[model samples]
Target: MGRVNTGPSDPTAPDHHEQGNPVTERVVAELVERSNTLGSDPRNTNFAGGNTSAAGTRTDPVTGGPVELLWVKGSGGDLGTLTEDGLAVLRLDRLRALVDVYPGEDREDEMVAAFDHCLFGKGGAAPSIDTAMHGLVRAAHVDHLHPDSGIALATAADGERLTRECFGDRVVWVPWRRPGFQLGLDIARIAEENPGAIGAVLGGHGITTWGATSQECQDHSLEVIRTAERFIAEHGRPEPFGPALEGYEPLPEEERRARAAALAPTVRGLASTDRAQVGHFTDTEEILDFLARAEHPRLAALGTSCPDHFLRTKVRPLVLDLPATAPLEQVVERLGELHVRYREDYRRYYEEHADADSPPMRGADPAVVLVPGVGMFTFGKDAKTARVAGEFYVNAVNVMRGAEALSTYRPIDESEKFRIEYWSLEEAKLRRQPAPKSLATRVAFVTGGASGIGRAVAERLAGEGACVVVADLDAEQAEKAAAEIGSADTAVGVACDVSDARAVTRALEQAALAFGGVDLVVNNAGLSISKPLLETTERDWDLQHDVMAKGSFLVSREAARMMTTQGMGGDIVYIASKNAVFAGPKNIAYSSVKADQAHQVRLLAAELGEHGIRVNGVNPDGVVRGSGIFAGGWGAQRAAVYGVEEKDLGAFYAKRTILGREVLPEHVANAVHVLTSGELSHTTGLLVPVDGGVAAAFLR
Candidate 1:
C-alpha cells in the first residue's frame, strides 16, 4: 500500500491555528463539517441550489497585517464540502465603507465602485449577491442558502403572521428585499435592532444566520428552517385555486422576431430604452386554456418564472392589438388607466396591513407588451436587462400556475421590491468589470483536435471568428475534425507526439506558418494509467508526466515566444482531470502527475501573465464521449480491479456524480471558451472543474 504523506511532527502540543481561538477553531470546524451535508442535504433537492460564506481577519502568510474579509462561498459552488480558499476573498472594511456611502446620489458610479473594490482581485468566480450582506454581518462566520422548507413558509399567505408565531421571539424578520447591498443593509439594520438576535429571515426571500463560529451559524440555519416548517404545519395552507389560462406554444422564429420588433419600441418608450430587451410573448389565457386539451399537452402549458417577476411582467399582458403600433398617445392613455387601478390596489393593500409603512411607488408600466399580431416586447436598460426581465416573467408565470395547483403563489411585497430595485449592492454587482472577448481576431492551435473536447473548443473558437489549427498525433483524425469545423483558414492536421520535442517544434512551425501567427494554444493531449503506485514504475511516472506536464510546458513556451514576437497577448489552455484532486484508487501516477500539471499552469501563468499571455487549465471529471483517453477496451482490467462484472462499469461512474449525468465534452469546451474569450479578461492562473459537483465530494 502507498503511504499517504504526513506532515512534519509538531515541536510542541501547540494549537494547529496560531491566530484562531479554540472556540473559533471548533466553530469553523463544525461549520465546515455541517456544510459537508450540502450535496446530500435533503434541502437541495435540485442538483446545485444552496450556497455558504465566511468572513474574518487573519495574518497573511505573505503580508501579515491583519488581512480582512478573507473568503466567502462563490456562485456555482456547494457550501457542503467547501474549504477556506474556495470562498473568494474581499476586504470587509473596504466593502463596509462602500455600503455606508449614499449610493442613491449616483447609483451607477457608487455601485461600480463596489464591484471594483470587492471583485477586483478575485479569480475564476465573481463575488456573489450576499457579499455585502456578509460584510454587514461582520461576524467571523456567515452562511446563506435558499432552503425549500423556509421558502415554502415564506411563500405562503400570512407568512409574516406564521413567522411571528414560530420564532416570534427568536429570529428577526426583514421585509422582502432584492439580494445584494440593499438586502445586506436591511439585514444590518435588523441585526442592530435586535442586538443579540442570532439570525434574520427575509420575507418572501430566505433565511440568514451568523455566529462567531461556523457550526453555530450552520446549526442556527437548520434550526430556523425547522422552526418555520413547524410554524406552517400549525398555521394552515393558503387557499386552493385553479391555474388561469395555461395552454401556450412557442411561435415560429420568423413570426416571433417580427412580433418582438414591432412591440419593441413601445416597450422601450414605456420602460427603459434598451432595444435588446425582448419580452416573453404568449397567447391570451382563453387561447392557452384551449390549447391545454390539445394532443400536445406537454407543449401547451408553458408559463412564466416566479411571483416576484410580476414586478417586471405586471399581473399579465393584455393580448390585444395586431401589427402593433396603435399611436403612442392612445396606447399611453389606456396603459395609464390600467396603471391607476394597479396603484389604487397597491395602496389599499398597504393601508389594510396596519403595521406596514407607506411610500409612493414607481408607477406600474407594463414591462412586457403583448401585441396579438406582433408578439411580445420587453423593456430594459440593455440586452442583459431584457433577458433577465423576460426570464423572470416566464418564471413568474410558471410559479403562478404551479401554485394554483395547490394554493396561491407567493410574491415579495412592495418594501422588498423597492429595496431591490434601488439596491446599491445590486447596482455594485452590475458594475463588475466584465471579462474581455479579445480573442476575436486571434489564432488558436489545439492538440487532440480530431474529436471530443479538443474538436469542440476548436469549433467554438472558429465559430467566434478565430482562425484555428487542429493538430493531433494522428494527422488523419486531426484533418477530419478540421474539415468538420470548416474554417476558412482551414485547420491543418500535422502528426506529432506531443511528448517529443522535435515533433512539437515541427508542429508549432507548421501551425504558425499556416495561421500566420498563433495567439491561443490548448495542450489537451494526455493519457491516464490506472495501475497502483506499487505497480506504477519509474517509466510510468516519466511517460505520463512528460506528455501531460512537460509537453504542456514545451507547447506553452513556443506559443509564448510567438506571442512575444507578434507584439500581441495570447492564452494557453490545458486539459486536466478531476483525478488531480481526488486520485481514484490504483491510479497513483496519473493523479500525482495531474496535480503537477495544475501547478505547471499556475507557474506558467505567473511567468507569462507579465508578457500579456494568460495560461489556465480545465480539470474535467468523467468526460463521457471524450477522446481515446478511456478507449481501447479496458473493461476487463477495470472489472478485475473493481471486483464487479464489466456490465457494471456504467453504473459505477454514474453513481459517483451528484447530478446523475455524465460530464460531456461540450461542457469542457464551454469552460475553455469562457477562459479564452474576453468574458473572463482578468482571469488567469485558475483551475475550473467542469464536473457537475464531483470535486465537492472528492475534497471532502
Candidate 2:
C-alpha cells in the first residue's frame, strides 16, 4: 500500500466548512453527536473511540475537482463533540493509486506528497485517518460508529472471514487495514463493486452502508448490527455469564391465551410463521434480572440488546409488576394500535419500492417491543424473531469494544443500504415457500360434486393428483363430472344422496375398493331453505340439518374409519358458508345449517386431532360470481334482503372486507388446497377467512 502520511494531530479532527446536501449534514451531525459521547468516556477511546466523516461528490468552489479522503479526528480533539469545523479533508485517490503498484518499495515520499495535497478548507484541520475510506463511500451520507458487539467480533481470530460466513450474502465484508486514504479507496472500490449491498462488515473494523435518507441508513446500521449479534451468539464460543433475567416471567396463561387468539393470527399474518418464542418481561425489574441466569450475561448487561434495537424497542424496556395499574383491556388496545402503526409503516415502505415483477411481501406484526410498565413488543416474520434481538445484543458489544480499541469502525454507506433494503433480488431470497398444490395421491370423495364449490373443489383436488370420487344426487351428472375431471385412472363418479346413510356407505365402499383406501373426504353436498326464523318450519330445519350437518357427520365417521384402518393420517375439508357467522337477510334455514357445518368441522378436528386426521373448513364468502348461483338473481335477492340496491350489491358486500374484492371460487379452492396438501399438518379447527377484509371490519 502507498504510504499515507499522518499528522501528529488527531487524523479524525473535524472541519468547519458546510458540506453540500441536507442528508450529508444530518449524517455529519449524528457523527458529531457520537464523537462527543465517546470523548466524554473516561477511556479516551481511539479506533474503539467514535469516528465521523462525509463522502461522495462535492464540487469544490475553488478547484472544481472531486477531492475524496477518509476523514477522522485530528490529534488533540475529543471526537465526542466534534463539529463540521473539526473535520479534516484529504485526497484518497492519490493514496489508493500509489498502493495499487507499490513495487515492494518505501512510500514515504508518496505519503508526504499526498499529505501536502490535503486541503484544510480555510483554517480547518488536516484530514483524519478515516478520510480516505469515508471519501470513497459514494453515498452523500455516511456515518460510522463502533458498536461494542462489532468490536468483540472483530477481535476474534479470522473475524472478517467469520463475519463473511455469517452475513456474507446479505452483507459485504472488507478486510481490516490502517484507517487512511488507501483503506478508504479500497473500501470505496468494494462499495462500487456491490452497488446494491446495504452494508458491509469491515473485516477487523466495523460496518459501512449508505442510504437515500438518514432513516434508511440508520435502519441499515441497525439491521447489520442485529445480524452480526445473532451470528456471534450462534457461532461464537460461549463463556459463562450471570443469571437470566430475574423476576422475569412468561405472560399468564389466561391473558396469554386471550391475547394470542386475538392477536396471534395478526402476528402470524405479519411474521408468517407458526413457531415463535415469545418472552414477556412485565417490568424493567426483569431487564437486568435475566442477566444473572442467562447463558450469556453480556446480552443482558446492556440497556438495549444492540444499538439498532433502539429503533424497535427504544434503548431499554420499561419495568413493572402485576396488578398493573392499567386496565388489561387498555393495555391490549394500546398494543393493537401500535401493531397497526407498525404495519402501516411497513406497508408504506413496501409501496415505495414495489414493482410489477416483485410486489412487496407484507408483514403482519406491529413491530412493537412489548414492555408492560414500559409497553413495547417486537413482531418478527420469517427468521427475525428474538433471534435478531439476541444477536444484536452480543454484536453491538463486540463492535463497540473494537471501535474503542482502535479509533473508529467502518461500514457500507446509506445509499447502498437502501438498495439492499429494496433490492428485488434480495427480496426474492426471503419469500415463504408456497403451500403445496394438491393432496398428492390421497384418495378423496366429494359429495354433491355435480356442481358448485364441491365440483370446483373436486376438480382442483383431482388436478393435484388426488384420486377423487364424484358422488352426487344425480348419477348421470356424477359420471359426466368425472369424465370432465379427466382423471380416468384416479377419479370415479358415483350416484348417492349424502343424506341417505345406506347410499353414502355404499358409495364409500365403492370408492375404497376403487382407490385402495380413502384418505380425504369433502363433506360438501347440501340443500338450503331461505325462510325467516319464524317461517322456518320443523320439516324445513330437519331436511337442512340432515343434509348439511348429519351428512358431514356420517361421511367423516366413515372416512376416519378408512384412514385409521389403513393406518395413514388423512385430511377432511368441509364446505361451509360465511352465513355461519355473518347472518345475511332472511335465510334462517340456510344460516342454521351452515352454522352446523362449522360446528361439524370443529368437532371433527377436535375428535380426530389425535387420530392424525386433520379437519378444516373453507367458509366461502361469495362464490356466486362465476357460478350458476350468480345468474339466478341471488345477488338481487341478497341485496334486497340486506336493504341495499341491487346494482351496488358487489360493492356493498365488498365493503365488509379490507381487500374489497369479491371472493372467487379459486380463492376458496386455494384454502382447500392448503388443508388437503399436508402443508397444514399442524392446522385444524380453524376457519380461514376468504372474505377480503369483511371479517376485519367486525374484528376491529
Candidate 3:
C-alpha cells in the first residue's frame, strides 16, 4: 500500500457532536435521510447491499478538544433502515494512522480487529470491511453502492475504455481488487491522483462516489448509475442473450406458476441437502427472459461478480438442463439426475479451492437454482434469507445483461470468489446472530386459520419461528390473521376451502412459493350443524363431514405428497373434538364427522410412518370464547340443550371436567405445538386431550 502522509490533527475543528451543535446534528440526520432515499428503491441498491458515510468534527469527551469523526454504515445492516446508532463512529485522524501499519493485503483480516483502537467513543456499531474506504477518501461525504447498471459496466470486457466513454473524466476506472484495508487505500490514491473527479468504478465490484456535500455525493452516485444505464441501452444489442430455446419459451402464466409450485419442494430439498433451508420463488420478466435465451447456461455458470450478491446466492446457481415443456413426471425425474451432477460439480469446486486455512466446505448445495420457462427458486435458513437471496440474484441477472451488451460478461475469477465465500470474517458474523427460534426454517400450513382455534395455532407456531400460511374460507380474514402473525414474508394468507381439491392444491402451491414446502400441517377447518339423527338432513351430514373429515383427508394427502417429494420428515396434526369419543345430544352430524377425523389420524399415522410423516390429534371439548362455532349460534343451541344461558354454556362444560377449566383456543394450540415441537418426535398417533380432564373422552 502506498503511504499517504497525514498532517497533525486540528484541535480547533468545530465539534459536530457537541451537546448543542445543531449544524453537526443536521448533517448526520441529512446523511441518514439520503441513505433512505437511495435504499428505498431496489434500483438504487439491493437490500443491505451498500454503505455510505459522512465526515464531520466532533467534541472528544475525554480531551475536551475538537476532533474529526467518520460516521459510516456498520456490518450486517441494510442502508434503507440505517440509523445513527447503526453507524460506526471513529476518529478520522486515528483511522488515517492505520495506513502507516496496514501490513499489506495478506494480513487484511487482522485490520478489522485493529479498527477497535480508532473508536471515537464506545463506537456506535461494529466497523464494516469498507470502513477504510470512507475514512481514507478525501471528501466530506462518500457513497459506496452496488446498483445493477453500474456493476454491469464494472464487469464489462473492455470496462476501462467503456467507463471512460460512459462518464468521461468524472468517473474513473479502478482495476479488479478484493475489498480490504488496502483496496480503500488504493481508492484513496485514485481519488487524489485524479483531480476534478466525482467517482470511480471499482472493477469487477461496484461504484464509489464522493463529494464536498452529502447531497452532491448522493447525486453523483445516482448520476453514475443512470448514465451507465443509458449507455448500455444505446450501445447494447436488443437481444444480447440470443434467441430463446424451442421448448424454453416462457410458459403461460398459469402453467408456469403451476410447474414452479410442483417443483419447489423437490428443489428446496436439494438445496437443503447440507442443512435445512426455506425456499423463495420468482419469475420476473428479466429472469425468465434470461433463462429462455441461449446464453443463460453459459452466463450463469460464470457466477456473480459482486461479493454482496455471491455471499447470498453462492458461487453460481444450479441449473435444470431439460426443456420446460417436458412432461411433468419426466422433468421431475430428470431433475434428480441433474441435481446429482450439480452436487458433484459443486464438491469438485470446493476440492479445487480448499487449503489448510480455508473454512470447512460450508456446504456443497447451491443457494439459487434456475429452471428455464418456469423461473428461479432460491433457498436459505429462513423466509427472509430465502427472499433476499432471490433479490440478490435479480441484481446478478441485471449485471449480466449490462455486461453482455457492452461485450462479454467478465466477472472476477472463481478462486477469489471462493476465498470470500468462506472468509473467516463472514463466519464470525454468522456466529454473532442470536440463536434461532425452536421452529426455525420450518413451514407450517394452518387450515381455517382465519379465526378461533386455527388462528391461535398459527400465531403460536409463528412465535416459535415457523413461517405460517393462514388458509381459510374467508380471504380477507385470512390475510388479517397472517398480518397479525408477522410480516408478509414471515406469514402469508390464502383463501382455501379445504374440501375443494383444486383449491387445496392451490393453497399448498402458495405455501411452496412463499416459504418452500410444508413441514407442519394443521387440518383444522371445520363447521357444525347440531341436529338429532331424525332431524339431520342429508345436506347437513355431507357439509359437516366434508370439512372436518374430507377436508382433513384432502389437506393430509396433498401435504404428504409435498413432504414425501421433499424427502424431509414432517408432522400432521388434526384438531379433533372431545365429541369424537363421547356422544353428545342432538349432535349427530358434527359428532360423527369428528369421530371420522379422530380415526383418520391413527390410520394415517400407521401407514405414513414409513415415510417419516407423524400424524396426531388434539381433542378440545368446549372452546366457546373466540370460537367461530360459538359465535355462529352454536353457543345458543348448545346452551338450550344443556339448560343453561348461552354465555354460561362454557361454565357448564367446564364444571363437567375434573379440572373445571374452560378450554380456550390457546390451550388447543399448545397441544398442537407439543405434538410437533420435536420434543415428542417419537410420540405420534396419540390423541392429546385439551378438554380440561374429561374422563369420558379419555383413551383407555
Candidate 4:
C-alpha cells in the first residue's frame, strides 16, 4: 500500500462526529472535510471544478414525507469551501429513475428539468449533473475528482491498461463517455458488474470512488493516486531536453512587468468580441519549465487532459513566440492575425463535429495564452475568472508533463471535446450567470486608493464591473485595501509614491499587466500642507507640487501613451480641490499646487484629444469622512482656523454650500465615473464642482 501525503499536520486533534442530525451532519462534515483535503491542493481541483456527494434522508417539502436524498455539490460552489447549503438535496430514487426514462438522444435539457423537479425542498439548489451516478452506486459516499496524479494516468495513450496493471481488479476502467444521464447509467452498470471495485477510472475524464463512508471514499481516492504515482515512477521515460536559448536571460522584475503592461491591451483586444476581457500572466516554475521543453508545442496541442477543463481553458491554447524586446505595435498586429486564424480553426473544428442538434456554440476565443519568452496569460470576462483559468492551465501543465514522462500523452478525440464544449448543460452554466456590470470590460487605475476619495473610486469602479489597481504609498495598506475591495480578479494593490516618475510608471504597468491595459485613470493622489507662506518651507512646497502637480502629469502622460498605443479612447479624471479655485489663508502650498494641476488637466485634454483621450477635473470641498488628510488632524486644525468647534465642522461645511448637503468622497467618485463612463463624452477640459454648491468654488 502507498502512503498518502496529507499535507501540513493539524495541531488540534480531529473530531470524529458532529453535533447535529447525527447521520446527515456527520456525512456533510465528512464530505466537507474530505473535499477540502482534496481541494486544498490545486493538483487535485481548481476553483469549483470537482464535486462530491453523500446519500442521506430528507423530508419532502411537497409531500411532507421522508425521501431518500443524495446531497451533491451544486453548481458554482467550490468544494474546498463547501457548506451544507452548497450541497443540493434531491430524491435519489427519482434521480435513478431518470436513467431508465432518459431518451437515447441528448436529453441534457430534460435531465436538468427533471433534476429541478426532483428537489427535496422548495428552495433546494440544483444538484450536480452526476447526481444520478452517485445515486446508482451502492456506497453512502462518493467523490468524483480531477486530481493531477490520476489525470496523468487517465490521459495516457493506454490509460486503461496502465490502470489495470496498477490496481489489478480493485479498480474498474470505463471508456470515454459524455457526462450526463448516459454516463450515469454506464457507471451504475460497470459498478454492478465489477463487484467490490473500490473505484472507476473514466478515460479522458477523471476518477470516481465510493465507499460506506467519506473516509473510505477518501482513502480509495488517495490509494488510486498513489498507485498511479508509483506506476509512473516505475515506467516513466527519460526527461526530454529543453529548447536551446543561447542568450536568453529572464528579464528583471521591472522590465517583465513593463512588457506585460504593454502586451496586455493587445491580448485583451484580441480576446474580446463585444467587450474587453481581463488578462493575467502567470510565470510559475511549472509553466516556465513546461514552456522550455523542446516538445512543448506537440504536448500542448494534445488538448486538455480532462473534459471538464474545456469550459475554462478551451480545447487548445494560443501559442505565441513573443521575444522580450518585441515592439508593442508589432506584437499587437501579430496577435491579431493569430487570433483570426485561431477563430477560423475553431469554426472548422466545430463544424466538423457539431451535429444539427447541438446548441449554438460560443465564439472561438482562446482562454489560455502561451508566450514562449514571456509567460502564460489567461483571459476571462473578469479578473477572478482569468485567474481561475490560469491556475487550471498551470495544473494542466503539470498533468501533461507527468503523462508525457510516463508515455505518449493522449486526450479525448476532438469529437468528444466538441460535445462537452457545446453541451447545453455546460453552456447553461454561463447563460444562467447574471449579466456583468456596464463597466465589466473596463479597467481603472486609482492612485492613493488605500483610503479617502481614491478608495471610494476603486470600490465604485469595481461595483460597475471594472477591474482596479489600488496604488498607494503604503504597500501594506494598499494590499489591505485591495483585499477589502475584493470581488475576485477585480482589484490588485501596488506600492507607489506618485511623486517618483519610476514608481508612477511601474504602477501603471502593474495595472496594465493585471487587467490588460487601463481605460480609466483617477489621478487622486495628493497631500495637504496647511501653513502660512512664511511657515511653509521649500521642502513643503516641493512635496506638495511633486504629488499634486508633477505626479498627476506623470501618471496621465503614461496612461495616455498606453491608451494611444491601444488606439482605444480612454478617460483621465484629475481629483483636484475647491482650493484650486478659491485660495484659503495659510494654505498656499496646497492651493497653489491644486491650481497648477487643474490647468495641467486642460493642457493634457488638448494634447491627447487627437488620440481620443478625454481629460477632465473634479473639485470638491470638505470631504472629511474617510479623508486621509482630515483623519491626520487636518480636520481639527481646519476647524480651529475657521474659528468653529471641531465637532461642528461637517455641519458648517454642509450649511456653507447652497445645496445644504455634505460633500462626500462617493459624490466626487460619482462625478469621476460620469466623465469616465462617457456620459460626458462630448464634454472634456471642464471642471465639475462637487462641493455642495459652494459659490466660491462653483465652475462658471
For each of the candidates, give the backbone clash count.
22, 121, 1, 2
Best by TM-score: 3
Model 1, residue 86: C-alpha shift (Å): 4.8
Against the reference, the lDDT scores of all candidates come to 0.58, 0.56, 0.89, 0.78
Better of 1 and 4 by TM-score: 4
Q: Once superposed on the true structure, which residue ranges of model 4 sit more than 4 Å away at CA?
A: 1-20, 58-66, 240-258, 322-333, 354-361, 531-537, 583-586, 610-612, 677-683
lDDT of 3: 0.89
lDDT, candidate 3, at 148: 93
**Top candidate by lDDT:** 3
Candidate 1 C-alpha lDDT tens digits along 436-547: 2345446688887777778888888777656678878788888878888874343567776888887886776665434445678988887766788689889888988888
Q: Arrange candidates by TM-score, highest first: which order?
A: 3, 4, 1, 2
Clashing pairs in 3: 16-57
Using all chains and alpha carbons, the TM-scores for the candidates as numbered come to 0.40, 0.37, 0.97, 0.91
Query: Positional deviation of 49 in candidate 1, in angstroms?
Result: 6.8
lDDT of 2 by residue, 9-70 (tens): 12332332345656446555665565565445422223223355543334456776544444
Q: RMSD in Å for candidate 1, one decimal?
A: 21.5
Per lDDT, what order, best first? Answer: 3, 4, 1, 2
